[model samples]
Each structure stands twice: as structure tokens, then as C-alpha cells.
Target chain A: MEFSYEVKDSYAEVKADGRLNMVSAPKLREFVTDVIAGGSSRIVVNLENTAFMDSSGLGALIGCLKAARQAGGDLRIAAVQPQVKMVLELTSMDRVLNAYASADEAFGND
Target chain B: MTEVLAERSFRGLAEAEAIESVHDELDGLWNDAPFVEAMDQMTFTTAVIESASNIVQHALPAEAQRPVELGVDISVRSTLLQARVSAFYAKPPLGQLEPGTPDEDSESGRGLALIEALVTTVTFERQDGTNIWILSKSPQA
Candidate 1:
């Protein structure tokens, strides 16, 4: 998987493509931890290019959410595809993380 | 000889979306074969995807470049699907799930639990460097 991180205004937008399975979830968490460790607690994950996710992927998201919250900020998700969204909804992640229609919207929420 | 409809080597990057695609493929396969049926597709897909994804995520935390392989097979006899999956992963603990918070409202972590609930039989095998899973599904009585 390829990931690109950009700090847009106040939100940290992480754009990812490819699969976010078990192998890649930790790498994603490392990136998130680095962001929070850097003092920027607000985060938005742009999964527009992501085609798949699994339990491990969901766990990583929950892990990131917990990490960010502990750091006094929140993590949000945006541009999740239909299939990906189904997993999130099934896992009930849609309830805690604010999902926006676009990255702009996710960032705009703050 | 077996026919191959989908074959790809993913670098331990099996995430939720990948799992969904697998489900979609099986859904399509349902029309062509009886190895997989509608009643158990969701459960089986969820289990397989979660299982594959777990391997990709945690099997080789110390190694950076080990690629995880996923192989699937389907056979139908009297509308009973005998599905075989080969993967390289460290197995989850026996017979129970480590609690995870997917969201209070989400019903997702039930991957393995759901898998066990839906399939007629579930088996896990580990050896050398590959894990093999055989999940059999039969239509509801």
C-alpha cells in the first residue's frame, strides 16, 4: 500500500491507496502515532483509493482513534467507498468516527 | 485440474475492502457453482477476509518484506461447498476472540464468531510457513 500524509491547515490528511489489511494497519498506526506524537492531534484519513479493509484494518482504525483521543484530539474518516463503508458500518465504526463525504468536508468539520 | 478465476499475491495487505472483494467474487461464483451458497456467504466471506487480513497484519511483525499468499478453492456436491484456503499467518488464539471495540453500534468484530456460526464446519491448520483453512458450507435445511 502507498500512503501520503499532508498537513492541510489544522487537520492531518493521510491519503492511502491499495489494501489496508493486517500487514499495512500497523504501518498506518505508526504514521498516526507520529502525527500525534508531533502534537497535531486532529486527523482525517482519506481512503478514496482504498479498495479493501479487514478486521485488522478496522482494529488499526480503532487503535488510531484511541491514540488520537488520548492525545486530546479525534480521528475521522472520509471518502470511504461503498464496500469499505459496509465493513465500517458492520463494525459500527461509523458511530464514533465522523465520516464526511470528502476530505474537505472532514477537515471542515473542525 | 482446477480452474482459476482469481489469483493474486498480496503483500500481507489484506484489509476489509479486500475481504469485501473476496465476498463479491464468491457471490459471483455462486451462480456458476454450488460450492458456496447464499445463506452462508456473508459469514464465510467475513471469516476468510478477517483471517487473511489478520495474517497480513500480525504474522511477521519482525519481518518487513514477507509476502502473504492467499489461495482459494471451491467445489460443489449436492449444493454443499467445500472451500479450501491456503495462507501464511499466525493463528489467532483458540476458540475465543480478544475483545475489540468496533463501535458500540457496529456488529463487525464478529468475524470469526460469525464464521463459526454460519458455516457447517470450520478448520484451521498451521505448519512450516503456511496456514490452511477449510470451510464447508451447506444450504440451510
Candidate 2:
């Protein structure tokens, strides 16, 4: 998977393109942590192009979320594809990770 | 027994890259069996990948010189999708093969449960130093 980030007005939008499986999960966590340390604790992971995610990938996201919260901000996922959504709901993480329709809407209220 | 209309197989060292190969095989299998329902395809694919990933992440070699090898054999029949994910040259899995109940914040321990939920049946067999998980799902017609 490829990761790129842009600091938006309220958060950093990280675009993760491709599969978010075990091979790429650690890289994603590292990338997102750097974004959090870059002074943008509010992070939005855009999964519009992320077609597949296994439990390892889901764990990476949860770890990233905790990192964001530790920095006194938050992290959310947007544009979740079907496979990712199924994993989220089946694991009951949809309640905790909080998925939005778009990056613009992730931290829109905050 | 129902005939298999489509199938895919991969055998390689149980490493990170093997996961991608198994995934690619699943993608190709779906194209070959487009008649399978979308939900069935999604769930079965997830279960298969999860099983394959588990082997790569956790399976330990039975001997110093013999490294574990991941093997996946997936087949699609008229109404069933099945996969046999194996960890060859590996030690028997430690402890009971049961799912864990992790709190929301936990990062790991959910793979087992997620695999169970996605597939209709999950069975494990240890034969000749290989740990195999057989997953089967009845495709929605």
C-alpha cells in the first residue's frame, strides 16, 4: 500500500491506496504516527482506494487511533470500502473507529 | 460430491509476501466463478486471507532447518466455496483453538473470531507436521 498525507484545515488527510493487509499494516501505523507527531493529532485515514484489510490491518488502525488520542486529538476513517466495512462491523470496531463518508466530514464537527 | 468449477492454489515460504500471492489467487478465483454471490465472495475471501495471514504471523517451524511454508488451496463449487490453509513444517498450534474476547482498544486477537464469523464452518487438522485449517462457506444462490 502507498500512503500520502496532506494537512487540512482541521486534520491531516492520509490517503492509503491499495491493500491494508499484514504486509502494509505496520507501515501504515508508522506513517500515521508521524502525522500525529507532526502536530496534527486529528487524522483522517481516507480508505477510498483501500480495497482489502485483514485483522492485522484493523489492529494497526486501532493502534493509530490510540496514538492520536494520546496526543490529545482523534483519528477517524473515511470512505471505507465494502471489505473493510465488513471487517469493522464483524469485529464490532465500527463503533469505536467511527467511519465517515468523506475526509471532509470526518472532523467537520470538531 | 459437487464438482469444483473454479480453484486456486499457492505454496511458498510463510512470509509477508505470500499473503499478497494468496490474495491475488482469490481475486482470480472470483473472476473464474462470477456466478457466486457478492456477499459469499466477500466473506469467503476474508476468511481465506485471515487464515493465511494467521499462518504467516504465528506459525513456528518445527525444526531449525525446516522453515514453515504457507499453502492455500481454494475451490468454488456450484454452491460452496472452500479453502484449505496450511502451515507446513510447523509445530502443532499451542493451546486450544478458540477465539479470544478482546476489549475494543486491543489491536490483535480478533483474527480468530473474525474468521469464525465469516465462514460457515471452520475445522483444524494436524497431519504430518502440518497445521491445516479448512474453511467452508455455502454461497448464497
Top lDDT prediction, candidate number: 2
Q: Clashes in candidate 1: how many?
A: 16
lDDT score, residue B120, model 2?
Answer: 87
Question: Tens-digit lDDT track for model 2 on B35-121?
Answer: 898888889988998999999989999999999999999999897888999999999998558999999999999989999999989
In terms of docking quality, how is candidate 1 classified?
A: incorrect
lDDT of 1: 0.64
Model 2 Cα displacement at A4 (Å)? 0.6
Query: How does model 2 score on DockQ?
Result: 0.95
Model 2 lDDT on a 0 to 1 scale = 0.94
lDDT of each: 0.64, 0.94
Location of the lowest summed lDDT over 10 successive residues in candidate 2 chain A: A29-38
Q: Pick the candidate with the highest DockQ.
A: 2
Deviation of model 1 at A25, angstroms: 0.6
Reference-based lDDT, residue B67, model 2: 95
